[model samples]
Target: MDLERPVQIVWQGPFTLAAAIASSTAPSKGVYQIYGQHIVFGPNSLLYVGMTDGQTFGARLAQHRDRWLVHEDDVTIRLGVVADLDSSARLADIEALTIWWHSPPYNSKNIWTYGGGPLRIQNLGARGRLHPEYSSHWKPARTPPDGEHP
Candidate 1:
């Protein structure tokens, strides 16, 4: 193996990534959330939504590498950082938006269920983009009083 030459090593695994602050709780108090795109490599190539409040792009990636846990498959991941400094919210909105957009199956994390039962699970891996909006297990809550934070 030559050190100077690039090598291709493939593996699949689980990841416990430590993300940089996606959106600041306080837009005025903190750096406005910069919306951007990053890349992730694994047995399954996934493009996820991400935003940050700081400039520790490389370090944030390093945290992903360090915390990721190998599953039945060995997976390697990489991220390319971009910025969108106009919004107060972080990547959560994008995550939900994309999950509803793509609807990929077998990816359960997108369901965002804290754990209840089958009714709580959702089809997260939809490549064809069919968002029918099923599951009525949860109810919507009314907004808090004006100028009040929930």
Candidate 2:
């Protein structure tokens, strides 16, 4: 989506997996980040970034509880609740941008192919291990084929 205004996300939490799954204050739909030890990235590095549109954060996080609970390095989660725009598409945009910028290892897809127009985002509050601002755009190089004139 072409976002004319910067999307503002107010991040909250560094909650344990159990706490996040039981958090009553967490937003029902938004982006989230998981941080924990990584073999290459070491301890407390961002591991995954995800979003939920139809499910509550508790429900969504609960789905991954088993995997995150297995980590020994104190896995924590952060929730990014969008300020004004709460559309699923906007949530997806925020999720994609966060993943693209951080390159968190657990996120295998959408690393290079977050296909959307230019966007601007402002991160507020406790944004663990994420930049305060992000600007995303994709412009592929184009060359005229066989003697095309400019």
Candidate 3:
């Protein structure tokens, strides 16, 4: 399950799609990390983790421009090119692993009481095995209103 690979610094420091165009590190496909100010777990200060297969990292970043964190001026972006060909599944797996590990607020599909705080899961199965307490925490993700996408 290790997707360890070298990642280039595609874009950083209050990222915007317009910035990606000026930077040479922009990658066409791979994983991306969105960092927020507060540290949630360990030394990793991540707000979201995402993967791009058929789209450019710039395009993907643009899609998230209106997210909650976008309102923050300190948010940054880092992108890595998918080194392996035909590794879309692996990239998806890595995305899940990252979200589970960091539990970023925006990734929360379902909120559960865990570790004396709320736990968010973008993909429950990706969480793999869990402690017995989590069984009681299963909750569905909130649906957006009337054709809106959250």
Residue 116 of model 3 has an lDDT of 20
Clash pairs detected, candidate 3:
none
lDDT of 3 at 97: 42
Candidate 3 residue-wise lDDT, 1-150, digit = tens? 211322112223445435743455566566667765664443325666677778777767777875454575456666655444345655554455444454566676322222222222222221221211221134334444686443
Off by over 4 Å in 2: 1-4, 138-150
| Pairwise TM-score winner, candidates 1 and 3 | 3
After TM-score superposition, the amount by which residue 62's alpha carbon in candidate 3 deviates from its true location, in angstroms, is 0.9
Alpha carbon lDDT of each predicted model: 0.30, 0.78, 0.48
RMSD of 2: 6.4
**Residues 6-50 of candidate 2: C-alpha lDDT, one tens digit per residue:** 888888888888888888777677898889988898989999999
Return whichever of 1 and 2 wins on TM-score.
2
Tens digit of lDDT per residue, candidate 1, span 1-150? 122321111111123233332322212211111112223333443433222345443344444446532122333232222133233343333334333333334244543332322121122222212232323243333353576443
**Per-prediction TM-score to the true structure, in the order listed:** 0.31, 0.83, 0.52
Candidate 2 matches the true fold with a TM-score of 0.83
